[model samples]
Target: MDLRGKYGLLIDDIAEMRTTVRIQLADSGLEKCDAARNIKEAIERLSQRRYDLIVCDYNLGQGADGQQLLELVRRRQLLPLSSAFLMITGETGYEQVSTAAEYAPDDYLIKPFTSELLRSRLERILEKKEALRPLYQVLTDKVDRAKALAICDILLAAKGRYVLDILRHKGQLLLESKRNDEALALYQGVLDQRATPWAEVGKARALAATGNEEEARQHLQRALDAYPNYLAAYDSLALLLEKTDKTAAQEVVEKALKVAPSTQRQRRLGGLALENKDYPRAESAFRRATEKDRTGFFKSHDDYAGLAKSCAEQGKIDDAFAAVKDMGNHFGRSSDLLARQAAVESLVHVKAGNPLAAKAALARALALNDDQALDPTTALEIATACFATGDAETAKGIIQSVAEDHNENETVIQLAQGVFLAAGHGEEGAVFLEATRKRMIKLNNDAVAMAKAGDLDHAIAMLTEAADRLTNNCQVSVNAALAILMDVQRNGAAPEKFSRAQTYILQARRANPEHRQLADLAKFYRKLAPPGTPIIEET
Candidate 1:
């Protein structure tokens, strides 16, 4: 290898580690290399320049961990196809953390590795990168599947050291091309030779793609049995359990967290707790996650926000305010956090018998998001705050919004209706809900007409474009998008269209909780999608 004209990034929390990796990369022919002590600096560098290689330490001391950084890059498609991501991890709990197969890197090097081992890993990655250069180029350029597959075929035909590598790439291409049977066969062929966890997981995903949940579970179990620390298999099993058994799903998440308690896993567990209305557990999980990493894939202002909401639900005012204070300190001057804090403050003031302060806090929160209405959960909070202060009119308005946007979200609708009943307006809220449901139905029907006319693209485009315009039509937009996606599938097209539709549907569901149809649509799309598409959590 020539020692010139290569760019690289080295990210580590320890000064010694950064210095060591930087010197090693320079020695290995990297003429240009930048080192960052933590994820924030790494992201800053990533935003400013392009690098051919990223050597990241798995345990960054602050901000995002190495795995979260890798996930963000891969999820956002930030890294170039030609780029090689080589994760460096110490032996401590390595097996537990090593289960991150879903966020696959080009290669990994264990810590305390000699220069020789580092060189060997890098050389192997470079060799594979070179071998698949043509396919990589086509993929990076967003060329059609046929061109990429053609290139993969050529490489697969003549492989020696890269034989397993070529098969993996070809399997990826087949999946991308929606040739599930061929991809399944290829993966099975690999599994037959060696019971590799990656190949087994691939087969399980293929089984899921073909709507064989029982078989998928069996394959996933096999992978888990062979490699008990395999995190990807646990993730797949969790997803499979989500629709069928909530308790089992929660246990699956807990098991994954026990193996390697990353921020992502904790956040998922927190979400499950929230769904079960286990406010204390949800609060603990969210708080733990926020305290662990200040900035990462799980570094959501929402985590703190959720914790505060959970505390308020359990009447833990002091704890709620403390969480709010943490948010203010962690994310200085964030509008999202500030708005959430104001909402919490309003609740606190009302509970403390300060009607004036509660009113002012509510106004400030509404002002912060440019007066945009809150979600059903937050609306319920606001309603409680307003009722505590004897502002029945404001409480009615907040509850009405919840009733209207969340007619399908039974949990929320019931909560809001309870607020109205407590405020002596149960009949009024019911009447309001009926009228809103009628309006939602009409809007949904109109969107469905466009889809039925075979204008699914236009229908989706129009619905999304008008999303802002239809301020109260959250359920309608989501249902319409799902309908159009199903129609597009019936007509048969590329998965991208369905992917786009799914994105909109997910957004709508986030805005309006418990849209069952969205879940059903997601399950349908998952079956139609090629194997190994990243599994999205059911909201």
Candidate 2:
């Protein structure tokens, strides 16, 4: 219960409220407390230092709020799992803050609360965090789920007070590791004991992962019917529906938006609506996302870029051009900015019957891609522009490059497909990306085969080259590390090889922390290396 050693942050727009809370926290033995006036200051503090606790007021000024700040920090990982967030809300915001279990704070306090009540809530959350520290360190710091899973089992076997919490973590770890049967069993076990909404949704996710999509959808529907405010259930159901029916997906998002609106959800709605050719809906969604913060932290070039495309699709050339111009005010000036703006502007000009302007814009976009391509998203955006400007070959070339570099990244691949879909080449994009994906798979397989055939050096060379070039591809990085480890396993491990292997393993972890095979690779490195090789420190 002692908060003397804990670093705390107090955020409130009103100066008097911040002073009151800081004094209260001091009275409660929390001396090391920093204060922020609003979301921007909070983010700056969080980035500069990690606080053990955060106390925030719900209604921050400038249309920003504590909940939105929490979501933003959590998404960007500015706030680690170890930190405890306590929201202070008045009666007006209690219902919305209370049922927002999707991204709820660790605990919340109603206004006019004493220091004792705040201290009690802090003690409880800190106690649970301490009990699960080992698991969190492994999962968050090392990205090793096997060790985390083992720790969860140990904690569960101890019959601890936080057994439910442990079980939830274990179930998620199971699903993430692709142990669908085990995950399903864990969820079912939890459901048998009590009908928790998370367990219900987890069970549905498990079922879907194991190829029981229909059954999963039914379970999700049932979960929604029972727990109407459970946002995760809505998101899970929406994702499933997206595979076979975009219309259903959009409808699900709409309902979720009705329940609780978020910047991420709005962007998702915009994407789905755009794909469905509902230009007005897309425009509305993207506009909301772009204008919601005005801080430019939550909104990306993608939002403005999306708004531009949505407007252009509706023959609102002026509105589309305005969006394209707005990008200059928001995102940083770089190759990415130039390319994205030009790309969207090309589409707008094309829609306005200005072929010369459209061609000029497309040329500038292509020039950026040729000289200094920054990110996959921008590359794909330029590809879309290429298609819009009647330059199919350049668009395909850009798509192919981005796809090869991000062969294992579904989000990037989908973004690439969106480019083609926007250009009336959905089927062709699907086919082209599929062929590229399969080809990459075959190449990786062939390298692995070569390693299995005792050609470790050649395999290492091929994989290392690919991994270095395609740095974003975690699968390639994993294989490269595996090839090196296989060599070390056969011949004695050299210090340099061990070091390089560790580097690749770490690289893969950074690229895709949620990669299903991450645990397997970590386990492999542990067994294949010297004692305390420090690949991933055990917590």
Candidate 3:
């Protein structure tokens, strides 16, 4: 308990809870403790500085929970590998989700516990982390599997109490590096030693990766049969089922939801139910998710829209409009929100036999759109409304744009197909989707050919033009930005080209801030620019 120099973060919505946890940490001899009332503030604090530990409550008011915060930190590389993250939750539902999560906190503590218990859990996690600190340090550097393997060897040779954890970590690293055969061997070795559910799941994943689908499924089923509440197993099994039997996948999702209900789980269930045209089930699940997720970062407006769609489909037009109103109330009337709400409202009006109101709503939605690039969810909602309101051309345009942007995604394609079917244009929608996808593919191919043929300027111009036309296409924008970056790099990033590259980077980010290539391009932009210069404009 000699925490002489430790500093930590405490996150909770309640002021009293923050004070209590701060006092507890201070009593543990920590030098300083920072407090955040919610995930947004917690993210700000973490970004501004580092902490030795983060004691986060499971529920942090609205817009994100502790788990989502942990994921953001991990995904964004905001935390040092040496940092210890401890989640405190009063809900038992957390156990199922935690166990199945690909990334988990160092440890979790259920609330209504004594300070002594909290300290004990913290100490144990710290000890384990310290034991594997070297391996973690190596992982943070470059993800070189050979070095990781060497470190794993050293740790395994000690044969300590954390042997199993080390083995599991090694197996995961192997999986990340695509060394599935080696990872399978590692999992098999663990299975021989102990029949742990985690090992079984890992083995199943490896088996699946090795193309032994049947064997993989058998192992997953065995794990689930033995540990009926194993959420991760259910997740994998559901994914496997999705490729062949959506009904089976829905069942698997339902079972997992029963074991541990979460906003994400409810949303997934709603989506599956909607896909199956089980309007009532989708309505119920989407309503539950939207209600419960009011204060979480993972909240999606899609849930509300889905609820509205369900209500409209089920002849509850009034409830559909109410859902739209609630969505506007909760998320505000930003252009995006307004556009989606207007679209759903139009559909609701149409369902209620009010064509004039529906037309007016559609006009409002089109006005709000103003050429903004649409996310798939919003596009689908808008398309559905357009179709319902007898605006087939607009609906087809939206669907075609979404298809061009996300043609490779089966889920989006399926959803688009469903929308077309609901609008009685299934065949036309199918043909349109295929045609748009082909056009996009050809456009991408031609751009690549231009670049490869040493027509760098032509490639850059072509994709930039495509970016304007495909305003909502993240891939097209990213390609344009990357093309500009590459051309700049070839010429030592001349000032003019650097500015153009920076402009495209900003444009791409505005289109899709989370696009994968934006980060790489941003990093390259920084290296090319003057020190401390900002590449992304504050919007």
Candidate 4:
């Protein structure tokens, strides 16, 4: 229970508050501590080094709070699962600190507490973290769901103090592994034992994954009615609504934002509003996103692009131009950023009825956009600009390339569809993206069929070619790596072939580290390759 060896961080914007917390923490026997005055510094420290614990103030200044910081770190994997997070808040902010966090802090303490109380809270949270350390170790590491789930089972069998926590992780693993029925059973069992908000949302996710989308939506609506502050349910419901009704999805996101002002959710709202043709709403949402984090870490090219497009739609030419220009100032000059600015500027010019300027900007953007290296978001922006400038063929071609390269990425596909929707080609976009999806699926199936039919050379060639062309496609890269590993199993492991396999495997991992087939394939390679052979290092 002694904290002498532990390192901790105190995050508070007010110097006096940080000093007070530090004094208490020191009194609690934790001598090693650091202090970050704001979100930017907190993020910098977290990225630079590991901390055993973080004691953060809930009301960080500049509209960026500790909860958002927690969410950011957890999503980016900057904060390891073994590290404990304890939120310090005043009584008025206690309700918010307790609920509405997309990623919850491990514990929270009200202000005006004694050092002894602070020590007790720290000890309790650290103990829970320590108890879950085995699972976190596997979870934090690159894909090893099997080991993680096994640890869940061991912990559950022990009936430890963290049973609900263990079950939560177990359910998530089952869902991620696509063991829908088992996941459903687990969530249903948890709900039966006691009605927890996460269990209900988990059950709903399981339902949707098992092809019961309607039931999932209904369950989520009920969950929202019961636990209105649950952020995850709102997110799940909004995603589900997007499949059926974009307007309802926008409304759901709006409600979620009212509960908690999230930059990411605001961006989603802007995207949805744009789709719904609600220009003013889109502009407002995009503006919030662009202006939320004074620190540049959370600013994105898409936010500015969305703002400009929304403003242009509402005939705010000067505002639209300002947004496009502002994007250039915030982000360092890069080819991709240049392309993004030009594309957005072209759209603004076209809206202002200046065809010559629009075409000129579009041309510049196109010249800078390299299909292979351009990111999906920037590529789609260029495509949208192409559509605006009356070059449907060029836009379609660009969309096709981005769509094919990121065929399995639903977000990119949706954005590409949004471009077509804005261009008045909604039906065409739908058919085009669907065709691209099928073509990519068939490409994989054909190579898989060839490999199964004992045509190793042709199959490997096809997959390797597609993997090289579509560097962002996880499925193609996985198939290429699998084909190579299969060949290695058939013929003895040649170092060069294994090396090629390793390359494709890493490509797949980079594209999508959570690809279903990656862990098994990597494990197979490790088992087959000679000990002295260079293998893929675990990240």
Candidate 5:
């Protein structure tokens, strides 16, 4: 527990606990300690400096809990691999969340513990981290997976105190690398030693990946029966159930939400409820999710849209309008958000029998789309509003574009079918969707053929041309940019093409700001041409 010259962060909501922890860390030889009362503050402090240790409480008021904060930090690459994180909790339910988390702290200390116990736990965690330093380095950095696995194997050969942990890490890497059979075997072996909850869940994951759904369900149920509050088991069980039974999946999520009502789980529950046409439940879930999300670092426009739609469908025009207002207040006036918000507002007005007001709202939505075409999801909202306002032609056009761009996405196709059915055009919608799918398939197939035939230039040209024709289709723009970047990478760095790639990327970003691939691509472009701004290395 010698922390001399090693900075640390102590996070806890209770002022007394924070003081106690700070004193304990200072007594343990830490140079100094920074403190945060919540996830937002913790993120700000961590952003400023890399700490040697992070002591975080499992619960931090009504906002994001310690588990969620850790997940976000790890996802954003805020904490370094060498920083030891110790999560403190009084609730036994935390074990399930920690077990299922993709990123875990170095160790956990239960609350109401003696300082001796805390020091002992920290010392043990530090020792284990020291032993696993090499494996962690390879795991965290840009290294070959095979090399990292080999390093794990070497460390495991010593039969050390961290043997089980090493096995777990190796199994996870194996699963991530698509070596499901080996991962399953390794998880089963861990169960033989002792049936830990994490091992059971891992085995179930591997089983599900291998298409052994029945066995996976059984294993997941077993884990839940053993630990009823295991959030991870609930999540896996719900996902597994969704493949066959939506009602069962919804129930599982409902059960999990009662135990740990995270914004993400609540939003998912709302989505399921919406799909089931349970307007009241969907409205409640989405409202709670929207409120929770507003307190976080990022806000989700989809949640606000969902809330407004559910409220309008339930004939709660005032609540629906309020939801739309909330979106405008929180997210400013981004065209994409504005389009969706205005569409939802129109739905409320139409439901309230105010045709004039509904028309005005729909007109605003249409103007937004005219300025910058809407993405598929936002377009769906606008189409719904148009149908409500008795503007079938405009709705049809929007739905046609949606189906054309999203033919491969079953969810979007289903959503379009629902919208068209609501508008009294089910049969025509089906025909339009089918025709659009066929055309898009042909377009995609032709470009892919050129790509496969080694006509990189032609393939890039074709995709870029399609992108111009489909400015709002994020997938097309992203794919076109990625194709060019890949070709350049394959031919060694081509600096001349970087600007072209960036243009496509920026366009795609404008169309779908939340697209996941944008982050990695931005990082790639930055490496190719380092920015003039100061660089902050990702942990």
Candidate 6:
């Protein structure tokens, strides 16, 4: 296969490896080749031009390894779908290279292999890519699920030795289309004949999609036990635990990290630590991820934010400031990031007996947003800043807004209540919360009645109108909308109507915290909709 027209990026820290690969590619007729000695240069090159192939070394000193680079490229949508990624890993042990699956490179090549082996692997990947060009084009263009399915059907009809591969692709397309039942049936059919890890994992994913976490956990756990180094199983299991059991989730993450210490795994572990409020562990994990994958997916402004938060919580003011400063330098002053930095800066100022500067930082953060409302997390940080600076009134106001927006969120409500109690306003806070709840109930009751009276159009109109009117009752409005959407779904309306209902459901969830019934309803409606249909936006 002549590769004269194909562009390639060769990334390796080892000069000899780079030279050898470059020569091999050139010899194989790939004339348009570029080489980078490390990830930083490779990323810079990638930013400047698109390449048909990326050949990266697994080990890159002081920067992103091959796995991390691949993940970053994929997650950020930096690489074209047709781009071929080949990981050249020196590690022979399955455990050592298991994390590579999490990134899902186009192919992998064990180092110390003959040129013939490399050529064969590259040819195989190219052949597969060529075979799936139509599918890839649809996926890349974000075409409708129905269109993608049609493409898959056409490909599958051409019987070949790669029929199983076609089945796998079709299964994935079905899942993406939200046809969990069909995907699950296909996966089950495959599993009935053989113990395929991919098929089992797909089944577990379908289970999760249908809101059967417990069953999904069991399936994934079984897969993990059967194939200990099956990295996909670990990823799915971690996702399940993340929603239900944080401790168990941490354990799964730790296990995956031990099997293959990729930057992505470390980043996930850091996220879990942050959620658990284990500041030290969070800091360690985030720092390690950033260091190991300097140019990888985990290296972003958020890592610095996590580090700063951990440092601030630990009272390491200077370190926190340094981290924040570095973050600002890397990614110009983002309002959210600056809000967090301001809060931590306020804490440091209060500790230093400089109240004025603390107040100024808060004002600047608020100003950056044109005085618009902050998100729950930013509001919490601002409240913390106010409390530290003895501005109880400001802190209370921010807390009130957060509490209103997240009334159904037990965690946020509890945190707000705790802050009030700590400040000796427990009784007052309780009274305020009670009044807020009453107002929310009344608003929801009114909306529900309108919806139940065969006035769906009017009810939807009311709900949309009420969104602004019930600004102080965010959760109430969201729940009301969700209730109406659920009713629409149960009625089995037109496809367009169902899509609109799904949109409202998503909007409601995004506006409020997690609600069990609402989540279930949203998932149900999603399953009901056909694959690839555009979800209708609710007016």
Local distance difference test scores for all models: 0.72, 0.87, 0.80, 0.91, 0.80, 0.72
Which candidate model has the greater TM-score, 4 or 6?
4
Model 6, residue 533: what's the lDDT? 56
The sequence of per-residue lDDT tens digits that candidate 1 reaches over residues 1-539 is 44266678888899987888777876676768888887778878888888878899888875456787888776666776778889888787466546685677777777787777777788778766776777778776643567777877787777657778667777777775668888899999998787887788778877877788889888887778888888888998888876567677788888888777777777778867766678888888898888888664456666776787678778887887787788787765756566767877886766556778888998877676445455556556567667766777777766665565565666677667666665577798778767776766766677778777877766666666655444555666576567656665777756666666666666666665434465566677677766654345552
Candidate 2 lDDT over 1-539, as tens digits, reads 67889999999999999889898998889989999997888999999998999999998866567888898898788887878899999977775676674567888899999989988888888888888888867766645678889999999999979898888889998987889999999999888987888899999999999999999999999999998888888899999999889999999999988887777788999989999999999999999998887556677888998899899899888899999999999877988998889988988898899999999998888888884346898888888878877889988998997898888787888888878877888899899999999989998999999999998889999999988877777899999999998888899888788889888888887788778777788888888788756656433
TM-scores vs. true structure, each candidate? 0.68, 0.89, 0.79, 0.94, 0.79, 0.70
Write the residue-wise lDDT of candidate 3 on 346-385 in tens digits.
8889888999999999888877655746567777888888
Candidate number with greatest lDDT: 4
lDDT of 5 by residue, 293-397 (tens): 544554577788889878988888888889989888777577888888888888888888999999999899988888335677788889988988888888988
Q: In model 3, how large is the Cα lDDT of residue 379?
A: 76
**lDDT (tens digit, per residue) of candidate 6 on 315-341:** 777877787677666555657768867
What lDDT does candidate 3 reach at residue 436? 83
Number of the candidate with higher TM-score, 3 or 4: 4
Could you tell me the lDDT of residue 261 within candidate 1? 77
lDDT of 2: 0.87
Residue pairs of candidate 3 with colliding backbone atoms:
62-295, 63-295, 63-296, 63-297, 64-296, 64-297
